[model samples]
Target: MTNKNRNYKPKIGVIGLKGFPAFGGSARAGENMMFYLKDEFHFVVFNTNTHTSRKTGTYNGIEQIVYPKFFIGALNTFYYYLRSTLHCLWDGSFDVIHVFHVDAAFIIPLLRLRYRVVSGHRARPQFAAKWSWLVRQYFRFMEWLFFKMPADVITSVSRPVAELFQTRTKRKILFIPNGIVFDEKSEILQIEEKDYVLFASGRIIASKGVHLMLEALVKIGYTGRVLIIGNRSHSPEYAKELDEISKSLNIRFIDLIKDKQLLMAYLKNAGLFVFPSYHEGMSNMLLEAASARVPLICSDIPENKQVFNDDETFFFETGNSTDLAKKIEQVLSNRPLAVEVAQKAYERLKREYNWKILAEQYSKIYWRLIETKKPLNSGDSEIQGNDEYKAG
Candidate 1:
């Protein structure tokens, strides 16, 4: 955040979204949000020098600064943010700084002293199943620091996350769930409607429950094509386990699809979309599946529940392979029921989670911050949680 006393478009310094092309959920969310609000504000995204070779580039009129990272890929978040913050402080131009995650936002305490910092509490990463006990404990410490720090506004993609942070602090926490822009152009893959199943994650890790899905498919002796899209760099051992279980089944593990249009093509053609993740704040893939009008089978986790109901999307008991198998069979066998569910979920997404509307709401908060730079208190927490946020 920086001073905004000039008569120009308000500038926002963005941190914590691994630079622009936006492969992961956090990065995708940041890119879409800024794209929607490009007319209202100017954005300067702080990226790692490794993100792109171009030291300075533009994505939809957004300025990007690829700052240097220390020790290669390790601790890039820390070095990148620290450098970006210092740049903002020295330049003293940006009116707001939006940090995407708790791990990337340990510097909020320092940033808030000068700028109206908006820290997004996206997930309880400390509970991530992929992390070791020590790593999880480190995430816990980061979360503790994030909540205690003074942020002007906190945005959560899940209502449960917003409520959880609200109980822990008096600062303003807004439950602004994720949204997707429906691709109206038809992208018909040469696959049948119920010929294959689709599962996608940015990283192929244990927390995503891909192994459970593979086991369920094995239990059912599924013979059709199964597309598992993601990279296995996150967990080689777990990925090897997945390969071991998937060998007996018709599983095709595809690398992560970074292009949204291509990903949508796969989603729209899939027989069913399975989301068996054990941890998440909100998922961009789930939102995209809904937009694609595909029947979803998600784990009965609170994060996924916030997006759709039992009738709208099938939910299996979390970590239960048998239940997931049963749900998968039910969705595949009952085509009419699956179609109804997909239609309903898509309608709900359009009504409640439209990206344009959510982007407008966020910009409104930014405008409020620009008008009056101050910390939000408990008294206006309720009023500020919704669209009429009087504070940042």
Candidate 2:
């Protein structure tokens, strides 16, 4: 490997996501990273299937490699990872192989190439209640195996996750929090006549605590419309239960929205944005709400607390519907306090959670890893690093 100069843009192979037009936090993270860093590096994102007419050879300027389609389930994800790994290994084009989630961590060991490996540990998948006993055990095993696997760098999106990995494995981890971008030109969706509207978005899974949100709404006798936008495929049974509960409660369930502008409109027009997740690596939805300057009420989980303090957000007990209801009531009843909190959150997002800032943070990490793998020459320029390396 020769020394890379300032102009040398590293080729990065991202191995995660079933395909393009993907959903969920992990997919968005990957897409946003590529968007912000495409000019700085050459990216080739791997997709499972591309038979659709809209499937293109590239997204933005990054290349996309499409593999044969697989069945929909955990097995499909495994197959996608396995196939993508083999392709990257054989092609030998990437300077770094960045895996986006813990499930793809096991494949790191099999990539016997000169390329560096970087993986993201999003959350404790084993702790998610939607998974069956067997599936949870498998996730637990994978979680354990992930730390043991050979990776040049491991990152977690939240301080809590970073601390857990550091404590358990005795290895340094990069804490690169998630970020949000607002579309200025996006048309705002008008909220109809309502005293209050509470909006929440994410995968409609048991761990997300949508049920708890619903229960809180019921307990408080909220008269306004409730909008929940998310994919329900992961936990259909739980979603059905939520559906039954929402019929009399004026709650509207919207499937995963593909349009960023429309989603932003929802955030912008909402009287309040509530996040009742039991756990998270870091919430993109919460960051978006903060970006849109929406008054926020979220569970007091470590991940949520990492992004917003008590002054910027109202905290409710995790999984406690009564407490959540009380917090919601407090925010709705007090308009001035809500506006103050929303302004603080928006300021915090500007100072800390902008995508450009996060992209620079990630660039530093990538350069550090790349520099470590190369032989240090006297003439080589050292990568200017940031203080994010100093763990708390």
Candidate 3:
């Protein structure tokens, strides 16, 4: 964003999402975009030092503006969002301020007059059980504000979210699902076929339904190993509870997997990958599993259904542990069916979920906004209500 060279590329400031060297769906999405779009745009990502302090520097060829972590939960998110938005506004170097999540969308009205803002609606955080009633209400208000606020562009990571935004705002929305950067040369873990491991990755929270997966495994009397990878610090109480539960079941929980090669190996070699999340904007883990060619099973949520449409064999009733157990058993016992599903998922990932294609779509959107707004010299009045973008 700060580059002023005559040969300068478009500068994009990404806010309200974790930066490089972080975990979770939002972080992964941000990282993937940065990886693919690094050459086309100069990215400046704002990283909140809520968990640990990271110095401001270039991470993976993109600028990282580190800010000290604040309070926990929605408060922390709002604080970071406000600070990041203010930083971008004051810097005046960012041509496009791309914001992620609905909470961050609260700053859209303030920035629309100055910078060309792209609001990415990742998920409906209002429904997360972790937040209190008041917090949820505040989030709902912010979501409402997001729809009402004028922005250069609006994008969603899943079809359901894109449709919801289109239905609510009556404006075109970009439907760009999260993608996986498949590692072709990573050493696959030599997990024995007889191990019959079950894999799941995400924040260890109730919304993710890791507890449900555990219950399902127990119900099915699955004696195989279960590997759950994600940040436990997200929900310490839930993680502790899961730890206690794991003591009685054949499950192992890895709090954080920093090694990409090892993580890929686990994903590539897992007997089955199960995603029992209750909600999601778009599950990066599901895409990763599919890319890794893991036989998949997930809860029958609209989000998951959007990705695996009519593939009812891989979905179980949401929140039903018994049904999930049955699906797990079916996948494990029916080797031919598992192979078929895994191969189909791999083909789909290669065809649709590659980051290279997704990045090009995003590049086009950014360029169009840049050209349409010409923010360098355009006045506020000239930019407002210029929503000429249609669905992509």
Candidate 4:
């Protein structure tokens, strides 16, 4: 453990499932947290994907150890965490260990005497329902094991997730906003003169509700183009179906977005950005839309409203195409109001959602937790063995 104002920067290690060029909000947030606190902390980012071979390397002055893969086929995810955790446990130079998910967070128990911090990025019953009953039970077991591990602090992206942790454990939970770096060129909502009124980002998957957006477009009588830019890596079949639906509805679908700048340019010129996801921890796509000054019409989830203004952004009922279509029509009819809302939302993002600020906050937490360990109960030593303490 090290003091925040110490002369020497503490060596901090960040572990994540995704590797460099960090994908999604988790990777982006992890990268930003490391970079923002680099002045006071030496960041060592261990990419779970490259955890192959015993080769040790350095990345931007940070120590990196590449571990070998143990599994080649279906057990790739299990092998990834096993290798990553073994490597981290072997090398004991890190002052702080921050894990993105609880899949392998159980490793922290062995280092109970050392400083450790775990983040519950996706340890919810709702997310677990994707698996079969037995597999879901196994996941619940793993989560409980991780929760019992001796960690100095915990962090969650949204209030719902934070509350989830509070209900299960006695540790102090912090609600940190996912950090975002908005493109300056697209940060301001320019009244782009356009006829199109629909936009969506991320993988073209059924869970993402792209089809719902397409159906909503059809209902809105939008004879104009509908741009859906994202990676087709996750779901090719879903993408094909979406393309077919778009064709049937006479809407245009942009297959992929290779360049981020170009993607932001498209969002900047669009009439509105629509994200009709079934559920989310916190969406990076909606944040990008806010940064690009695009009027947002998203699912009325607790996560969406946490990022954007309740009044500025139009919220459609989750999984309801009719509601989404009506919201889209409502926004299109009032262009001036939509533009004003977009401007306000952009300003809010700039003030509250910047990665740099979030990084600073994370850095402070790391320092505070490292210096003073959270007090434990005298009777709590045997609490970890209790089956009743297991995560749901």
Model 3 CA lDDT for position 38:
91
Better of 1 and 3 by lDDT: 1
**Which ranking of candidates, highest TM-score first?**
1, 2, 3, 4
> Per-residue lDDT for 1-392 in model 4, tens only?
34554888777776664455444556656655665666678877666444223245765555554545445755766766556566667878777777777665655665544546545454343352235687667667766765555366666677676666565676655667675765445444334445565555545667678888888887776776666776766676777777776774646566555445666667778888888887777777778778778888888878777777667788889989999989888888899999898899888877777776666556666666566544333223312211112221
Show where candidate 4 strays beyond 4 Å. 1-4, 48-71, 110-115, 122-138, 144-150, 182-202, 250-259, 375-392
Mind giving the per-residue lDDT tens digits that candidate 1 earns over 281-358? 899889998888989999999999988998799999999999999999999899999999999999889887777767
- The sequence of per-residue lDDT tens digits that candidate 2 reaches over residues 152-231 is 66777878776676756634566787877545675667655333465555578888888888888888887678888888
Cand. 2 Cα-lDDT: 0.76
Error of 4 at 87 (Å): 1.4
TM-scores of the candidates in the order shown:
0.93, 0.89, 0.87, 0.82
For model 4, the run of ten residues with the poorest summed lDDT: 383-392
Residue-wise lDDT of candidate 3 within 65-163, one digit each (tens)?
888767566467677878888887788887788888888767897787678888777888887787789989988998888777646777777787766
What's the number of clashes in each of the models?
A: 0, 0, 0, 5
Clashing pairs in 4: 51-67, 52-67, 52-68, 53-67, 53-68
For each candidate, the alpha-carbon lDDT, in order, equals: 0.82, 0.76, 0.74, 0.66
Best by lDDT: 1
Q: State which candidate, 1 or 2, has the greater TM-score.
A: 1
Give the higher-TM-score candidate: 1 or 3.
Answer: 1
Runs in model 2 deviating more than 4 A are: 1-5, 50-56, 71-74, 182-196, 374-392
